[model samples]
Target chain A: MTRFRRPSAPSRLPLPPLAAQAAGFALTRLLRRIARRKPAILSRLGPHGGARFLIDLRDSPLLLLMEPGARRITAHPRRAVPRHDAAIRGRLPAFLAMLHGVEDGDALFFSGELEIAGDTSAVLALRNALDDAELDLTEELAAIPGRPFDGWLRRASGFAARQSGLALSRQEAMR
Target chain B: MMELVCPAGTPAALRAAVDAGAHAVYCGFADETNARNFPGLNFSRPELAEGIAYAAARGVRVLVAINTFPRAGDQAIWHRAVADAHAAGAHAVILADLGLIAHAAEAHPGLRLHLSVQAAAANPDAINLYAEAFGIRRVVLPRVLTVDEIAATNREIEVETEVFVFGGLCVMAEGRCSLSSWATGLSPNMNGVCSPASHVAYAEVGGHNEARLGGLLIHRTPKGAPVPYPTLCKGCFTAPATPSGPAQTGHLFEDPVSLDATELIPKLQKAGVTALKIEGRQRSRAYVAQVVRAFRAAVEAADAGAPMPAGLLAKLTEGQAATTGAYAKTWR
Candidate 1:
């Protein structure tokens, strides 16, 4: 294991530059891992379906994840509606009535609150896959120390420091 | 001189605004088609027609705001609102939402269309895009630009520009915030209400009053210390501690400050704003009359190259603080 000199200040001290970089790198890696698993979730939803959604972000980022392939859709901050297409753009009450069947996760990826740009079908499919997956990155990230990146880097660098014989600094130790 | 477009939630408010020297008065029908869907607010069909006649008698114009997005599969309601406004002799109808604007353009060719701030078309390109596509005569700017940005926008867009000069302020881009819907499942764009009263609940716990919206505690304040309505973006929250220090407590999004642009009337006129809008369609007629009268005096002073009148509506404020809000870069 790496070790390093400890910094003096505990509360008010800033993280060393190396620690920050390590944290950022770990975050990117984790994000990539999630992205890689996205296809696995999509495959379960079949291949060509679409769901419209609205995500309300009161407690968390309101998402409208949809999986058109698997004919699955879900939402959060539940209102009413299963799907709203361009054809039903003006009947809000009816759309809301349909929203009642939706779950919180379904709204997160496919809701009207999110404006979907190009590849609408693909986005809808991606949303479904995301909703069905047992991923809880938001919760996991929340529990981590510092901003998500800082937490990852601090832990990674701390491990590296222990193997190196350098004394772990106070700043690194607290992180 | 620039036209003064004032809000009139009620028939009495409309008459009072016209009497107080508003060049034009904007109002909405008493229904879900309008943003201020509060009970006992807005005008009836006959009242709208009468208000229009009254404004016409005084050489003032009346614009109807049918600004809410039509619900999906139910376009008739919004279509009727546009048709009714035209039938009632409104000078124009303010609108947002692409689908609704397209429908109005096709259905009511003769009626003028002014883009509402809900469009959030801040840049010149977006403004021009709407003007070119829908023949929008005027665009009510979102409260996100500085005077310099407004001036630049005026130079680029062919349509007239209207800016809010006083009253309620929104920190985020209007129609783009999901904070309300996230908590209460109602949105300003879709439901025409933000931090709606139906979803808000207040409780006194210990010596503090806690403001809860959709069952989430948003603000806790000392009793009788003037608890601001818990608008999600303007509430105080705790940010977790960072490596740099412990957690910080304060408004993470924005402060509870209303926009009072009276002092910037001349600068806005110089920036080529065609009209000045005063928000508050849910206000009392007395509030409407007082604000309109003060703004009229200020506009007249601006036209004459004189200083604005001082401290006009000190008593009208909710918490005794006002901001120019993003009109100056200092807001950022």
Candidate 2:
């Protein structure tokens, strides 16, 4: 199993200007939702100290979240960082080492492929929490038409086309 | 004629496969270069050289598998494996990682490159990307595509395609799954092991036996029933339901079934697959010999336009039943 690396920012493509702008706005909204849920989700992470982290996904924009004492959580969207939190970052494999070891409150940041923006320790706790949560939202996400903006980005970026080897058939893409 | 590639985890297995009529025998180094990084399996450098010599003497080819992705900053070890395999007279080196493939193609232009199944090159576009970017000569297609899809893919791609005909089946996309890593720190792409035996624990709970992998309760069965290994994807689990219904419990992803594409041999050959690979490098030498001989006979029958063989190794499956898997359209 290859460890997940935060995908680097895509090289600017020759996409239609409006489509690119729409993608940017859509990504921002998605990050905000993730940011808003950080505190509530972190609270369920059991007891752990806070850490600062960054999340860099290929389909989504960058995310920087901080949890202090595993209670208060702050999120910064689309911000550049000086350095990644190696302590938390170095343990990416360890975070994935076991499913149950992940907690919601631990702060984690993505860099390189993923960049971390702030403190390292708290981020690790948050990562643990997310892993422990047995949230099965696949069907729910499937129910809502276009609920996951990331899926839309994948479609827009031609990744989904690559998956099916055909243009999004109108029916499948709509569902 | 289409090639008959076979699996050989050990030097003894390699010789046995050759004797049993394998056109090419694929094996990996004793470390993480291969997916079947099981204890007491695979070949050392000298062992591999000797195996290649033995195969060459018998007019059989030896292909070395160094398919695992090279870790960041740890390219040297994987690169060295590629170099050593080439030096040992391997017919080709099977690879998966993008960087590693690039390294091998540039550094050893003379060596033939076959894409490992772990690359998950399921579509014509992905296969073309690999062929265009790395000059890969052959691709081991993922076990996710239907026969029709395989035929379509063969039409669109420039490289020869290989498909699995027997052995363990992966429900998820090959090389893309993180379930094993999520449960056990070791992953197939990184450590070359999935649901490693070391991390497995079985316990008696509530008068039933529960099989746990990396501390997650993956399987629970009545005391007398056969308990399956807690491979993350194939295990039973409960998923929370929506507001409209109660939670559901079962094999949400897939049941524990091994693939047997023997029945589809003619269709697969017509679909233009260049070779059929049997997936079991960790299997016993006897098992390897048995499967290779059976498959070789099957392929020859298909080539001769004869009827399919009967009673072909019924006792070798994990369970009494076998599935055509994603080779047939209904599997999707």
Candidate 3:
């Protein structure tokens, strides 16, 4: 009953080349920070550590390539999406909902809102690792080790989430 | 009123299930001790102990599932799981292997036992045998029984009976299927996974999403369509043409649909079922909470003598379709 609603309009977030590069850099930095704090997220991947995953946003032209073994993520245009072990295609809200534990990933996949291809096991391993780690992106990004910009990051994430109607942090009340 | 027995793959899921109104939650150690032995899933011993405490504090019981059959030479591994489960103050240990059950009964006489569905004790004789011999307090009936059959079996048995009301559907007889092993060389009964993700692959072939299990084509969906996880029993295949007929193509064994018996909660309660189990230990905590909440509402409505909630969890089913599976005797 608490399923995330599919956006009524076919609106896509616009990311120019420079914006995409900056977003990718921010994402990669955040992932590396998370990996350093929670090693189990990568360690639990076991043999699938080397698998590269593609986060294909169906409504957007941007794609995210995640290499857990290297603890890095890079953004690419849809046409330039590099070779990867697996790919998951969904809308931004769906991905954010799953990442924030606001919705079930399996339910989203089962409902036909998400599409996965290539190596299923690698994708599954990544999913399990993330689930086990229970990462809250907003919280992780905000804890910037001795940096005063932590507050600004939290504020920006909250503002972005509010403006876009996306869930970027764990909803404790829902849980 | 029937107890709501939910699944929790992690401590967080355990808390979610409890908060969502589960009467009990079942889990297993992060090894081959249970059927859902997937990577990055299940609990360590300390985590299990902590989860038990968390559930116990909330008045929700935690049942340890050591349901996988023991290997010939590695009985000790399964034995340690049972012992550790009891030591962690588990309400009961859900067991499948007869030898392992017997071992638990002998070694820890104080520990309560429940016959896992993997035992395939669909008949009253088998149920009674397990109850009398091993002092099993409950029996998780397999998915092969109809409501009338379950009622009849309950009439002939003395122990409590539990049934799966939701989640993945296993068309094969529980604990006896070898399709996964035939394809992957790894068995659910021995290694604790069926159609394991490690051996599964998905490919974009000719604008179709082709799902393969152990290198064998199982299902294919047109691009952008909902793709099912390539579980062997529910896979699509082409049966070679024979002299008698043309080749058959489709879900040869069973369709990739999940079991959603929520509407039958009243009937199952009338059938003398002691508990209703939701089967998704490999799922996320959000999923666990969502399902637990819905089932709790349905069970409450049933207990209050009210109509069951309509489509309480329609969106969460696999393939967005649900089946009563054998419980209604649909074939008949």
lDDT of 2 by residue, B75-194 (tens): 898999999999999999999999999999999999999999999988999999989988999999988889999999999999999989888888778888899999888899898988
What is the C-alpha lDDT profile of model 1 across B62-165, one tens digit per residue?
99988888888888998999999999999999998889899889889999999999888899999888888889999999998999999999998899999998
Among the numbered candidates, top DockQ falls to 3
TM-score of chain B of 3: 0.98
> For residue B250, what is the lDDT in candidate 2?
87
Give lDDT tens digits, candidate 2, residues A8-84.
44423334445535654554554344445543344433243333344433343433333334332232334444233
Q: What TM-score would each prediction reach against the true structure?
A: 0.64, 0.63, 0.92
DockQ result, candidate 1: 0.01
Give the residue spans of candidate 3 off by over 4 A: A1-21, A59-61, A77-80, A145-163, A173-175, B240-247
Ranking by TM-score: 3, 1, 2
Error of 3 at B49 (Å): 1.3
**Candidate 2 at residue B66, lDDT?**
92
Worst 10 residues of 1 chain A by lDDT: A101-110
What lDDT score goes with residue A22 in model 3?
Answer: 85
